[model samples]
Target: MIRRKGCSEKGRRSPIYRVAICEDEAPIREALLQMCRELLSQLAPEHQVEAFASARELAQALADGAPFDLLCLDILMEGQNGMEFAQKLREENERISILFITGSSQYLKDGYSVRPIQYLFKPVQREELEDALRTDLRLHHRPRTLTLRTGNKTTVLPIQDIRYLESQNHWVVVHMREGQQTFRSSLSEVERLLPPDQFCRSHNSYLVNMAWVAQTGRRELLLQDGSQVPVSRGYYESMQRQFVRFLNLK
Candidate 1:
């Protein structure tokens, strides 16, 4: 899953971030990464950052399970451009904030559809870069816990340990590494409780944890546990996108 791993940006305090820079030009790419490091050093002391020559490389790393809180993407390249790539990213997970870097103003109107946190133009000014990092978002990581109640007993489980959840008549069954647990609740209710960036509605009967998903097809999702879950026609593309966001995949 990893080609080469740099320093792990484990947040030493609250409001830590994971950031990436995807640019085709080496000079521009290094400049952006340097700016990020300088700003993050002041704003988020423990942020993890990475640089990529193309969008494809960044997408591959995400697929391999590297967590990125923010992605700094470029708009033009030899292959998949940043605007189209960002659109694809939106379909998966919607939590990672994006910052687009480009030399052209033509894509501005079109790029806004993906809702980037900010935009930095070519020859980016240090003041603007500083403002974007400092005054904008002070994003925080979500806690890895799932709280469920089944009658008189209540359970607070680690999110990483759970695989998926299935909804029956009036209850939801949680399938996890240990086994299964059931609680009287609707799938919607459970979905609301879980982090949107990590879970998705695979079908009307199922809510899946994106981390455990192995493979996906037009009609079903394969989980690490070797179980197949149906993917409703309405949610097919969206489900794939959600998995992409979850895995940070291509």
Candidate 2:
């Protein structure tokens, strides 16, 4: 969803700006994709812009491990419409930016609930597109920081840097790319601080980041870093479902 661009690209953590344009009409879809390609080309040296004639195609691409930074959706389509797809994305992941393309202003009010960056009415304007693209770039490049206070020291860690969190008694250790930081906090308290779409509890003692989770076995969750996190019997189903959803997001 709101992945920090090239997370799994190149060697490791190489971020790329990716955009997905979903529109049923072929002409519009191609045109929109071209516009995005042209825009991103001017903005970044390396970028990918893809177009799908239907929402289903785009959804399938995402389900198949495609990384996308922003989604451009058309409200009306053949089967599953843009609104429906947007709602589904919200349920699965919350960080990806969404911009709706509709022919009328009537959908503007309805689109507010999805927290979209903006809407492009019929005959998309150059200025409007540029503004929305700029917003998208800012969100994708922004660093996600999380602050923790333990004893007399306070540590700030980027949310993406953290692979998972493990709690023991009243303290939780933040497992990150570099190393671990201990903080005086409960697992539930730490969970509350993170965005629900990105992290989930795999056990009473473990809070896992969906982004870095590589695989899930019968007894444990395997992270991309080759670390194993315990998964309790009661939390197994939830963790499995979360993992499936996480895969779908990529």
Candidate 3:
């Protein structure tokens, strides 16, 4: 499933994405595994891909606490089909991205029931499969963690959990879903470390996460947490544009 997790350690930057492939045919299964491994090596070098010859095997792995960021499943199999397995998996884990590889177009309607990312026909083309994998990566990828230095203690915060950043004189306050953490750093310095596309400079002293923003106006932004952040005139237009672009991506 879409394995999203918070920062667990210090100084670790790259996050590994785990992918799985399920196809009964030995040749097709091997081919799919190779394609996925090759593409992920270029896109995300720290990724992993596991191949299963049947849906039951994949299900057993999941039951054994195996985590997967994406699943490349073939629709038809020996006992349990891909669509049936996907439906069962979705009940427990809805975050995982599924890419269906089917032999016929008849399963197209049923595939949508589980909300798959894309469907590729039999004898899948490398280009089409690559495109589907790219989409899955985009949906699964998240911004890196932000290391905050607070006095003698250091705090590592996942960028995705941060709702906003506020500048209070020489100190910066990191507002997150859990709580707030104050650190000695300038707003500009913190801005430089954050991803430009995810964090927007709403005001001279405030940087807001577009993902947490619910509504935007000329002067203020309403966040999902019901907090209002001021939007400076200089950054209002840019904030609006960025928010729109972020929405389109979602």
Candidate 4:
């Protein structure tokens, strides 16, 4: 595994970002792994990088609860090809970023279905690899955990698990798949803490997670949880544009 130090508070350590590389060719896999370690050391700072020789091995690791934020996949392989594995993987996960590396451009059109962040031709250049990695890092730069204080109690919530946030007067309600938590904070204050690309202002009183948005109408948005959030006339156009951009980027 590859590891590096990250920027953090005096008493807190940076959250670990997990990355995986799967390539059947040993020489190519080793070269890619080293490049990732070197690039991520400066780009992400704190991360865990793992390499796999086959798609099955990586899939098994995922089945055993391994978490990866980014995947570097080689197109042609011995048995199950990278494109097939990525298509299957997308059925279950829609957020993870994929970067495809191949020697031939024959399968370029097929790769678009899975919506990879970028594609690289083999004999990969360090500059091109760095560009793909930079895009992935920017998309996932939000803090993993959010600290909330209510009365005398303080709680930490995983940012990705949040579905949407509702503002009620002086208190904000944090909605999640598990339940809800009401905290004494302004919606604007919480919005400042979240990444702008991932979350958007649906209305003056509501902030919606773009990933949870299933449908959007002229006046409202339908979340994955089946709840509807209002979209004011002023924010509707911009919200739709941002949501479309988010979908394309994903």
Candidate 5:
């Protein structure tokens, strides 16, 4: 719940983002949780965080009205692969930020379809995670509420509360301010639902909100929260021009 200056007037309600992590491996999951705790302690102590070992378990939790702003997911899992889980999650909702984690580069092609915020290799590094999270928080726009359906159940998600979105195959994972949820959808489709001015397609596989942008150079996009997102050659020029214009407007 780190409120930006000039965001509130006296007693006005302040905005809070939710973050979550879903990794099947215990060691990796613990590492992610520790990193989250460290980052939030320094960057956004008021934000809430939750952890899950599998998509099914996390999905079930989200059904209870949890708000997840960001999600860090591992590709391969015991019951359901991350991709399959993401598809089921995005099918029901499309407004949260998602970041994928895996040890293999082969997953990259499949990942792009989901339009994750970014993809990170396993053995999760603190610096990389921090950069991704911060960039996501800065760029999010037009906070709205979303309703998701799973089997006979429905879940309500508040957009402002989301920190980011992650892609797993045909599924997109929604990370909110309170808890994490997954859905079945593509990154392109999720982009359609987001506000263009706020969320920018920085890479073929990633879309980031401008507000979270801390700094940008010819080759990189830095998030205020301290994460660095790559500016691919294909998208570099267009993103640079658009970002420059965005700055000028502000």
Candidate 6:
């Protein structure tokens, strides 16, 4: 089990989150290595970090069965670009979390097929990198129980108990198997707390758990409890790809 600094006691300690960064530029590569070391020290003290000057080097490392939790890849390089390398990585290991570090936004739309966790514009910002780390942590770590407050009472709920979330005017409604509970938080806030592989934003106002999905069509998702949620057209393709990956279908 992997343990994160701010995680609850019930949360299991994660196995070392081994990471690899692939870049061709010496200065950029070294900078990323330094940032990774600093961030891991603060957020995941026991994590392991590795660096490669090119995708070929990283690919060789991966072929050796060296488990990597996250991959920070650059879009352009001397030989194979990040996209091509990512394709190979996906073919080899579908579960590894990928984040692209690129100078251009042109490749952003193309990253969805690979199901990248996030895209960081170089030079990466501290806040952006930290946010990406938080996302990665949730993906690798199990959900923890959280204490939430109602009008006059405090209730402890395991994060896994939440099946979906809906946004109201200013508050978010958490829907569990038992019933719906209102919480004073934004949808984005709730999103940040949930695991990326388990949860997805289906609509502007709704987020659904893939675990409870009974069926999914082009524009809707049917939950195990017989609830149907609409999937926004904007997120349709990305959601479909993720759903397939989640089901281990391809």
lDDT of 5 by residue, 1-250 (tens): 1112211223221245577789888888988888888886644534677889998888887788666767777888889878777767778766667889888887788877667889989777888887677667556523355455656676766555544565678876765545667877677766655544456667776666666788877677877666676677888887876677557545
Indicate the TM-score of model 3: 0.57
Q: Estimate, for each residue in 81-109, the C-alpha lDDT of model 1 and write its tens digit.
A: 99998999999867667888888998999
TM-score of 6: 0.53
Candidate that scores best on TM-score: 3
TM-score of each: 0.50, 0.53, 0.57, 0.54, 0.52, 0.53
The digit string of per-residue lDDT tens for model 4 on 1-250 reads 1112222323233456678999999999999999999987755556789999999999999889777878899999988989999999999987677999999999999999999999999999998997787677666544667777666677878777899999999889989878998887789878766655678888999999899999999898998889899999999998987788678668
Count clashes in each candidate, considering only residues at least 3 apart in sequence or on different chains: 4, 5, 0, 0, 50, 6
Q: Kindly indicate the candidate among 1 and 5 with the higher lDDT.
A: 1
Q: Model 3, clash count?
A: 0
Per-residue accuracy of model 3 over 1-250 as CA lDDT, tens digit each: 0122322123232356688999999999999899888877655646789999999999999889776778889999989999999999989887778999999998899889899999999898997887777666656555466666555676778887899999999888889998998877788777755655577889999999898998999989999989999999999888887778667656
lDDT by candidate, in order shown: 0.75, 0.77, 0.81, 0.82, 0.69, 0.77
Candidate 6 local lDDT, 9-107, one digit each (tens): 233434456789999999999888888888877555457889999999988887786677789999988899998889877885767889999999988
C-alpha-based local distance difference test score of model 2: 0.77
Q: Pick the candidate with the highest lDDT.
A: 4
Stretch of 10 with least lDDT, candidate 6? 1-10
Point out where model 1 deviates above 4 Å: 1-15, 139-250
* Alpha-carbon lDDT of model 1: 0.75
Error of 4 at 95 (Å): 1.7
Q: What CA root-mean-square deviation does each model show from the true structure? A: 15.3, 15.8, 8.2, 10.8, 17.3, 11.5
**Candidate 1 collision pairs:** 62-248, 63-248, 92-241, 92-242
Model 4: CA > 4 A from native: 1-14, 144-250
